[model samples]
Target chain A: MEPGSEREVLTLALGIAIAVVSVVKRHVFRGLPRARRLGIAGASMLVAWTATVLEHLVFFEVLDTVEHLAYFGAALALTSWIVSVPRGFAEPRGPG
Target chain B: MNEALQIAASLVLLVGLVLTPRARTLSVPARVAVAVLFGALFVQQVLDVLERHRVAWADPVGDAIAGAVPFLWGGLLLLMVDRFHTRRLSAQRAQTDSLIDELPAAVAVLDAGARVVRTSAGWRQLFPSAPLDVPLSESVGPLPEALAAALRRTLADELRGAGDAERVPGEDRWWSWVVSSWQDADASGAIVMIQDVTSRVHRETDRESTQRLAIVGELAAGVAHDMNNLLTVLQLHVESMRRRSGSANEASLRSMEEAVQLASEMTHGVLRLAKPGEDEGRAQVALASLVGDTVRLVRSTLLRKYELVLTSTGRPATLDGSATRLQQMLLNLIVNARDAMPEGGRIDVSVVATEDEAQIRVSDRGPGIAPELLPRIFTPFFTTKGAAGTGLGLSVVRGVAEEHGGRIEVSSEPGEGTTFTITLPVGSHARVPQRRAS
Candidate 1:
């Protein structure tokens, strides 16, 4: 009902959606290099969502810090993955 | 420290964005989504910094951008994953196409409507005019009608799989085809494979002819043995009769002996045909004498309605070859000429000696071969005569000529006549000139 509460809900929904998509299309990531970093990024985003939901019950300051840390972790992993993309990714790897 | 970590993460994200190879690999929309994703994360980092510094209006902006960040990540992940799948599929399709193209057998894939989807290199070689996306029957090539009809039937589900070897009309070639229906998730069609089996068919025919010849040789040997015994008995009786009835029966006895001698010579010719090994060894053969002998043998067996004429240039035309095989070759040409004229016509057999070769010609005043059919006349198992012909005559003549280091040529006028000329290299043996004979 609050002005910012809706944004939290939407973020939580998107995190869940991303998790479901990753699980369903898990085969897509099998051969990719540094794919674990991408998974870590997704896990960090999920953790941030959980911390946002638990902020009212737990130590508010601590939970807020935890959420920001999780977001930072997700951003760091995502950036690492982006920078690590191989030059040959554009070229096809299979026989023609 | 948390705000410091956030600023570090944002800076790393910005650096990654600038250096990521995905900028060149990803599609336009995907690249934009990636940029937006990094921007949102950077904005969140900026909001964290501002809140840490007690700036106003940071909370609301942080909430809104935070909400958008996850969606952007989701969109970017989906886009990159989709791009990977597209590349993999494209690679697999390319591999399949190359595999098909490299296959030795002519192969084609058709849609449910029987239109060609793809073809192999062999298919292109076989049907150079056949183009992609065209109905096979409409393609300009020697695709047999039977194969096209079978393909249609197969695609229509009226036939499961069809295969046959068909001789191309007007061509001495034979093609074999196999068609089968294939069903995939998105489509159903037929795969057609074709092969040129002309040589295979010829080899099988030659094998069968060899088998038949072996059987005929055995039979001829037995008949020749019996005929020789009968001629020997007749010769003894003629000699006995001449001694009993002195001068008065001399002429009759001599005629009886001459008939017996002719019968003996005929039996010898049959024996020679039976035991090919006896004449397989090449020797100096006088073409004129061989032609005369063959004409005599043919005259004795031929119908009286046909006129047989033999001529020579009086100059000896000697060749190093199998005498019996040469005789058989001449016999086949003469018989072929005789068959051409059912109403009986003049067959001229001639031997002419040149400086380096001997030319033997058999001319017939019967209907000649068509011009279009000339090239195929020497092809094994090709025949112009309906059911009554064996189609092996000219091919045998050609084989024997080539075997003797010679060549055979034919010229024909459809209504007028046909002449078969066989030229053999002259042997190094001494040439013995003789008087002109007819």
Candidate 2:
């Protein structure tokens, strides 16, 4: 099998695992405090973005500056999620 | 254009979430949903940036990023279920807490191990030192232990029942514990309600004591009636004998007559305690003579320098009541007066008869009762004299006055003296003939 093909299968498996974890621990996520919930969500997004980046890198021999900058934008969103924890989203949960 | 606008709205929302203090109170799940919403929008922009850059190494990597989007949606769905489950449980807890607090019965909800999961306000008050998680035996003592054990056993066996009445050591409460099995969606336990019945036991004991006193009184009155008859016969026989042997051993006859009279008075005193009211026939009593007689009975014992004085007007004054009880009431008053004049004082007993009622006032020149202590003086068994006083003297006086359809009034000054005035209702009865002892 080709190296790129192997990487493709590995990324697919990684994506499937992340999906399973998100489903299983979804209730737990609802109970976490605001800072912690946002932190975990941001961390998970960073992991998913990194996994996708590795998948993108499998076919190319080298990277361009424009793509690096675009990747930097994804990093910036994850950073915002981390630093902005205290005032994260407001909504009312029913009666509980 | 729509995508660009969504990106702008999402960025604005993200700023609000991070900067505002108002967002802190929001529920975790609610906040998670909002965070997930903003996450999805932010990630979309990242994906678009990725696609626009179009690196040749990509092999449909957007699919992996797309995978994360589904999770955000999945987490929100689970959060909704969690919210419903938690909300119902919390509401039930608050509802039970409020209702059990209002109940007079002390209630405790225990887990399978007999640990207190929750308790009512009464339960908290009953065992104020106990914590929510303390064992039932530790909190309420062994009083609740057997009951809790039985309830837990019922749960273990999947049955339902109650426990017998039990007593808590070192406490007077008689507890009757009833437990119902508690099984809900999440857990199983027992709902124990404990009721105190101490007062009921005390009431039953008092009733028995009262009934015994009544029986003893009846027997004494019966004996008195027979004795009165015998005394009457003796009086007749003595009179006949005296006529037959006139002036021979007159002193011996006089002593015999006095002995019989004394026996009659003793029997009447016995009957008085046995019965009250119409059981003894009422008669006209000369008020002034009775007061003089009662005072003379105890005058010698009065502390030195304390004079016993009686005064009355030859008014149409009479008392219609049991003579024995009236005399007893007057004797009690005399004793109370003597005690008041511990150092030396004057006691004046006077009778004033009106058409409606007759008033007798016993005034004493002694250190008067303190104003603050006056109201409690008539309460039974309340005394300032400690071991020297039975405290029933004034209480008996007030009782007798009331039984005769009247009340006693009192007034006093700190250094001056105290006066007790007893008034009795006069029905359509004639005043007794005047008989005053000096």
The top-ranked prediction according to lDDT is: 1
Model 1 segments more than 4 A misplaced: A1-6, A28-34, A53-57, A60-62, A90-96, B17-22, B140-177, B220-264, B277-328, B334-357, B361-386, B390-438
Question: Model 2 — TM-score against the truth?
Answer: 0.51
- Write candidate 1's Cα lDDT for B1-438 as tens digits: 667677777787777667554556666777788778878888878886897788879988988898888888788787877777777667767878889889878999888988889889888998887888877766635567787778778988747555556887667678888898887558899988888898788678767866776787689889999989988988998888888888898887887888899778668867865554454356778788888988998998899889999989947877766787778799899999999899998999989987688889999999888898898789765677855665767987887787677789999999999999998877563333221121
Tell me how each candidate scores on DockQ against the true complex: 0.52, 0.07
Worst 10 residues of 2 chain B by lDDT: B429-438
lDDT per residue for candidate 2 within A9-96, as digits (tens), equals 5544554565567557766555443535444444454454444455456533232333233333433443354345444232323455
Cα lDDT of model 2 by residue, B1-438, tens digit = 423433454465456345433344445665667566555545554555555568543324544444455456446545644654565567667666777777766888888777888888777777778877767777667655566567767668756666545666666466777877787787887778777765565455446645664676688799899989999999899888899999896899998998898788878767655444325656877677787777876785676678888887646666676677788788877777778888867888988887777788888887889887798788655566876875657877887777777789999998888899998776464333121120
Instruction: Give RMSD (Å) of candidate 2 vs. truth.
Output: 10.7
Deviation in Å, model 1, residue B283 alpha carbon: 10
Flag clash pairs in model 2: A87-B17, B217-B274
What C-alpha lDDT do the candidate models reach, one value each? 0.79, 0.64
- Stretches of candidate 2 off by over 4 Å are A1-96, B1-25, B28-37, B45-64, B67-90, B104-202, B229-256, B266-284, B298-316, B319-322, B331-403, B408-421, B426-438
